[model samples]
Target: MKKPLNAPVLIVGGGIAGLALGIALRRAGRDVELVELNSAWNVYGVGIILQANALRALRQIGLADACIAAGFPYAVSLHHEENGQPQAARHKPSLLDEGLPASCGILRPALHNLLRDAALAAGVQVRLGITVADIRDESDAAQVSFTDGSQGRYSVVVGADGIRSHVRTLRFPEAMPPRFTGQGCWRFTLPRSAEVSSAVMYHGRQARLAGLVPVSPDQMYLLLLSEEPGNPRMPDAELPDLLRDRLQHFGGQIPAAMAHMPGPEGIVYRPLETQLVAAPWHRGRVVLAGDAAHATTPHMAQGASMALEDAVVLADSLDDADSLESALQSYSLRRFDRCRRVVEASVQIGQWQMRPEPGADPLALVREVAVELMRPA
Candidate 1:
């Protein structure tokens, strides 16, 4: 992939996808500038699981070692009864075959810090507390206006803003809004224990899904998924009691973890929602990627992974293709169906969990998706 001359690229949003793309492009000796709407550059949530496929993408940009150093690595996903008795353990399929763990769990901020440092080190100019106010695409270049009353011309403009993307609203006015998936997730961080080695999930007899994910050698986090009929809002003050009450059906390490709730700072609750942009992700020199293109539920744990994959693929496309149009088209063609499958499959899993039948096998659905994800995205 040869670098293009005078290809000043403007990327909106400095989250996972945006930052990763900045690193990739800069490492390839491309001129790129990234803008993030958040001035503080804060990242919410506790921990995230990086599946093998996500790790592969990160490896492409030479950040896998840093990620592993900052997170906990595990090769298995264990299912347990409410009493903490082991029910079944499914080992994730290894694609790299280089003796690396199949998946990893890391604190969200830790991952963010790593990516930010790498992006800065690669010479990618990052501007915070700014956003794109306007975008006009022409035959060979894109003119972008900033909220700070600044303008620039670039070979390409990427919208990695997120699900509630301003670029999506401005570029694709007819795009459908993200839909609620009738589910909400509750998370709490806790100290890691000797007994917790892998991602262990407890299946409550009353149809609740809760899990303890090890994020590091001495830290871990708990995640609970329950049905939310109307996508109700949850207040921060009530999150502790609500989470404790919901964990009553489970009897294992969950009780002990619940006992150590550290006020509102330790708890995070969010309603599950998803969105999938139709094909033709690019309009002339402006393109969309990551959550702006496809957002999914935590059921399949592929959201961040998808974003990382998008960054690597997009950078590669830009380098390999002959022209800006060719590069954006190649990036879209490579990512569309792969992302659609993940979004649809993740939503399907959430739906099945919402309405579990007497003989329904949720594990089968999970295994099917996991197997497919083991393949290159």
Candidate 2:
């Protein structure tokens, strides 16, 4: 009789996707270990807009209650016109009658810490201070060699290491390189007085997008997005002046937010990019998940949620397939369609927003395409 394969399945990232996967796979009675690249051991962002589909997927993985406790739920999401006027276009509760609420806003670090605590409580081993040295494709199992000269061979390996993933680069080199979406996103968190209650987004000239995400009753995440400028180096003292100049035309809450900004020390500039993989997401005992598989633009706020969904599908497929490769194949078949749809949709939204001038009026666009968007494809 052959010894049953019992090594822990390895997850290469400890972000939302990998942590959720660790928790879910643990709930499913599978052993897993999450290896994170960052030595700091904390999520970096200030906040994110959580989607309903993501909430439901978390429920499927037994994380619903925990997630709810960690974020603030809102029944509506609003979009505004370029002149700082609120538009009639809104995502209301009805749109999510079959899904989660319209959205939840969360402090990324708080949420990550909560999920990490849950994963640890559920008995997922997390190994820090390690890097992948090499990967060997044996007939029976894929072996992952670490820099410390430690090797782990398992029945399955999940590549959730994020965009620029080592496993993806090693195993599927021909896959699409990450493409920059030609936008620069600057985000910051400010401690706000408890007077603000609503989340808001502004569309301005050249289609710049600025938003305030209230992650808690006490703090808000402010984001200003513009076209990525070449040789984009600005001094710390110059940031505030630059922001004020760029946002002066937006008026309303936008200019006020800029006026009240916490300054350069609080801001982080991120250039957006996406990766497309046009292959089987797995080979033998290895499979990709999260940004390792598909990293999308943040326009729709489905990036984190899509990764959460990946975990549930992967666990379901693994439990159902007879062989490891077959399990990976089943997982790809189950998740590829939905994940790809989200990635493609996110990119489309980014493309539409990153125009050289002010975007078409949402009212006009809605009148023109809302019916088509609502129609069955």
Candidate 3:
């Protein structure tokens, strides 16, 4: 009789993609171990907006309801002019008429805690402050050496690591590195007001984009995207003043929100980076998923959702395939087109935001992509 499939799968990185895959694999009756570079499972950023597709993926892993309960869900998006006057508003098209809201926003730490706890509860072996030092992919298994100097042979090694994935560096040495998208995003948390009922996007002249998203009953966060070439790193002390200056050009509720900025602690800033690793996301017993395979810009707010979808699809593929190679190939085939579309569309949106096309309606592009993403991954 043929030998059974490899056992004890090893997942590198404990981020959303890694943890979600760990949960799904363990549920499929496979031995799953996950390692993270950070000792403490911490997350940065003020808040995250979970689009409907993301909620659908989380719902598959049985964590959506808990998240929705802990977050603020709203179905509408308001577009405003540079002066803060409302230009237009649209409600997300409901994919399912059921009670599920179109989208939700939550504090980043809360989402991380939920996933980490759920992964641990699902019987995943999580090792913190550790990572893969070396990986040797053989015919049937991958021999992985941890940074801690310990070693284990796993049936499959998944690189769910983030955009700067060490696993990707090791596996795809020839792949292009992530590139700056000529824009950077600034985020800060502020108290919510009664007037801020929906997610609002403020578009100023010269390709300036800002958003106010509600994360809870009493809290919201501001996101500003501006042209920042080369992804320069700014000191923490200067962040508060720099962010305030960036918002000075806008009016409406933004000025009020800017007044609430406590200091540097309330601000988070990062340049947008993106990359789409070419096909064949696997080699031998090693495979890649999530940002490791395709890291997209945040214009669509589908980064986490794409990662979650990757986890679910990968686990399901392994369960149905006759062998490991078949499963990895199947996962790549199912994922490539969908991910490419999102990455391309998001990058296009960012490009358009940086330089508006004459007489072009960029909002329509945003809406088109949103409708496309509403379909199942």
Candidate 4:
């Protein structure tokens, strides 16, 4: 008889992917234990944009409505010239069953709190300030040694940890390291303007790109993308001033938003890096999920969406398959191609922004990918 997937599962990270997977597995009648390295579990970033595909995945696990209620929902995206003259607008089609919006912009903290609460409510055992020190995949189970000196045996081990995944290093030592995409992203939260109703993107002549996304009724976040020749460590004290200097060339509501920019503490900046682990996301009973398996740039805004889909699909596969190996195989087979498209497409868009060619159209590629992603994950 094939081994049953009834034993407890271990998740090594408690970020968006880890939390979502915990909820899905618990709902599927599996005992889940999640470990987060951070003790306080503080969420970083100003906000996040949840495209329709992401909402669909969240809907599968029963969190879509709450996310929509807590976030600013809209379906329109406006493109503008450097001087703020409107160039074009496109409406995204809804992917959810009910009459939900096509996309949502939400505060990172708010979304994190919702997932954390749902995972706990679903009876997931969560351990903070702890992580896996070592893992061994045996015939019957995966032996895990926690950083806290405790040990456990789980039916399967999932590495949902981010790009710098310890589990990945321990398991797949041959995988390529994360590659820098030669660009950095800057984000800051500001009070929303009444005129800002939809997602707006500014094609700047002086700067590469900038965007404004509404996170709530009275709050919005600014995202600026620029080419950083060599990845430089920007100091926090100079972040606010540096961000303002970058935006000075653009005209529009940006000046007004800049007026409300707070101290360096309120700004968030990070160099964009991407990684996609090779197919067969699992070896033995140990598997990889979310950013650990595929980390994409924010150009497509599908990083979190892909992670959420991974959770739902993985749980469904485990419940439907007869053996652990086949279940994990099905999960990777179903996800690899779609995720590869998103990752590669996002990187291409970032490259276009860095070096513009005569015929390159990032917006067109975005639309094509969006339509493809609307399909079932």
Candidate 5:
């Protein structure tokens, strides 16, 4: 018989993964406490693309409809040549049972707000501007010391703290660290055009990739992926012009969008990085989820979806297992392969982009992965 998980669950780093886990566990009738290092709880990225699988996962927690309503839902991705000529259009089939759209594009803050509000409504205890300083896994529970000079004991401590996770550092000192993927991403927001109803990609020279995604009814975000030899960081004051220059080769609506680019403050830039820890994602009573265990490039747009699936599966495992050890093992076993596929595939696509093969088909690989992801997480 499985033992009931009646003890409190401590989730570190209240980002997408942590918040989703908090909501899932709380809905499962477990006590959950979430801590975020940032007091204001601000999100950095301009927008995110949620694929069908992500929406399916969100549906399990009653947030799928809300996300669909808030974001722009689309089923087709349009590909164009560097000079604005249409190349191809790929239509994605809906994975949801109720015929929901195949994908959604939403602002980062909007998605964060939805998850945060839902987590709070589900009765998660939230502590901001805090993080774990130390964690000692005892037989009965894991004792945690917070950076704010507070302490607590919980049945399990989950590290959803992201790629540079502190809890992961303390727990898995020997695990692999995050690696730079030799590429940088740039994003800028602009008014959505009437014709921009779906995701549009423009393949540029020298393997540069640019795309436009509608985030809402009236707003869309432009994204560029470029090879950065040393991952150089440009000054914030120079980001606007720099991004404009990078997109100079892209035609279509890109030129018009660039014309209205805001000052440096409007540009969002980040060097792509990825990490995937080898299995056994848990040690003692400490477990890692989301980017803490596997951080993938945005090439697949499955990073956040994978995190959401982790939260749901972890909660389900805990509820069905006979022991904490067995539950953690089950969760890791189920998640590792799926997450690894995404990380590897995404990295592979980025690598191919950096060094294109004569007959390599990234779009085909993407379609293959998308079909695989249509299965239940």
Candidate 6:
């Protein structure tokens, strides 16, 4: 096949990773097109916590200020258990003072809007309601065939698709698969007036975790996590009672917050799965990003942060390599090690959180230490 006259770079999946990649390529002066499978954006979850490292990645992409503004400065996380009083604390010098941005939390949809707006501002062509049917590379250029029957090519194709990435499966079937962590989460938006003042995580015997995060004066984000996969179909009439039952002992803001949990219609439940692809991230003009490459569990709340990191690094690796093949090699070199470490660490942490009984406290301690050491020095 012949390359188009003005073939723009193609990006599959317009979630955080894909959109970020489009933005990065645009900044690098590349004509880019991003195709999203969802008819529109789908970020209707709880708040996302951005660690200092995530902020640094946004800084590289120059979207830090806007993203930070769209989110509340969640400097500290308050953790408690059924019998323990909540403990409020901030990151120590080991991480925060290391130059990473203090952890900040943002409503999922709000952050999506921020990234989408910035992409438009950067001149990225974003197409929603579009699914990719196929992708190919020829004549040193990549081609993406969409379910919409349209075809386009570029010198590079970045698959920022998520864990269920069609691009990754179609292109690289042997790639590492998403591993179930035996964990799941349910997210909902509760009225802030209900009583959650800040971010809080309440731990339980089976490591059942419930949380609330205030995104604004009137709204708060609530998420409930369980040690095993869950499919609790909470009804409208039972939503509040259900949450109250799970979070009753979580002092401070949680109890009151659960009292106003959204009705069944507004509740969203999703499972937790992590992926590990420690191999090359690309094939000639094609490459992977975001969950397509590393779908991490939320144990340390670093999945999204890692995706942002992937976006920046993928873009940085393609600086004037001799060929598209060469550029892909560079992308893998820059990303595999960092991503592998994160994947391994997240798995360990998640396992620690979900482990049964007397083992919980000791596991949490180990996780805490590992997290501190992983932060940039």
Q: Which candidate tops lDDT?
A: 5
What's the C-alpha lDDT at position 376 in model 2?
Answer: 17
- Structure candidate 6, residue pairs in collision: 52-101
lDDT of 5 at 76: 96
Q: Candidate 4's residue-wise lDDT over 225-296, tens digit each?
A: 988888999999999988888888887778888888889889999899999999999988889999999999
Q: lDDT for model 2, on a 0 to 1 scale?
A: 0.72
Per-candidate TM-score against the hidden true structure: 0.96, 0.88, 0.97, 0.98, 0.98, 0.86
Question: How would you encode candidate 3's per-residue C-alpha lDDT over 170-264 as one tens digit per residue?
Answer: 98999899988998889988899788888998998667888899998988999999888667888999998888778889987898888888788
Candidate 1 per-residue lDDT over residues 1-377, each given as its tens digit? 45474658888999999999898888788899999999998898599999888888889888998998899999889898988888999887666585456899999999999999999999998899999999987666788899999988888888999999999999988889999998899997889978889999998754479999999999999999988788887888988988888888887788888877878877999888899999889887788989999999998888998999999889989889887778888998999998998898888777777777687677777678778877776
- Residue ranges of candidate 3 with Cα displaced over 4 Å: 1-4
- Model 6, residue 39: displacement in angstroms? 2.1
On lDDT, the stronger of 1 and 5 is: 5
| Per-residue lDDT of 270 in model 4 | 89
Between the candidate structures 3 and 6, which one is better when assessed by TM-score?
3
**10 residues in a row with least lDDT, candidate 3:** 1-10
What's the lDDT for residue 123 in model 4? 99
- The pairs that clash in candidate 1 are none
lDDT of 1 at 60: 86
TM-score of candidate 4 on Cα atoms, chains taken together: 0.98
For each candidate, the alpha-carbon lDDT, in order, equals 0.87, 0.72, 0.87, 0.90, 0.91, 0.70
- RMSD after CA superposition, every candidate: 1.5, 3.8, 1.7, 1.4, 1.1, 3.8
Clashing residue pair totals per candidate (backbone < 3 A): 0, 0, 0, 0, 0, 1
Order the candidate numbers by TM-score, best to worst.
5, 4, 3, 1, 2, 6
| Candidate 2 weakest lDDT stretch, 10 residues | 368-377
Better of 4 and 5 by lDDT: 5
Q: How well does candidate 2 score on lDDT at residue 232?
A: 71
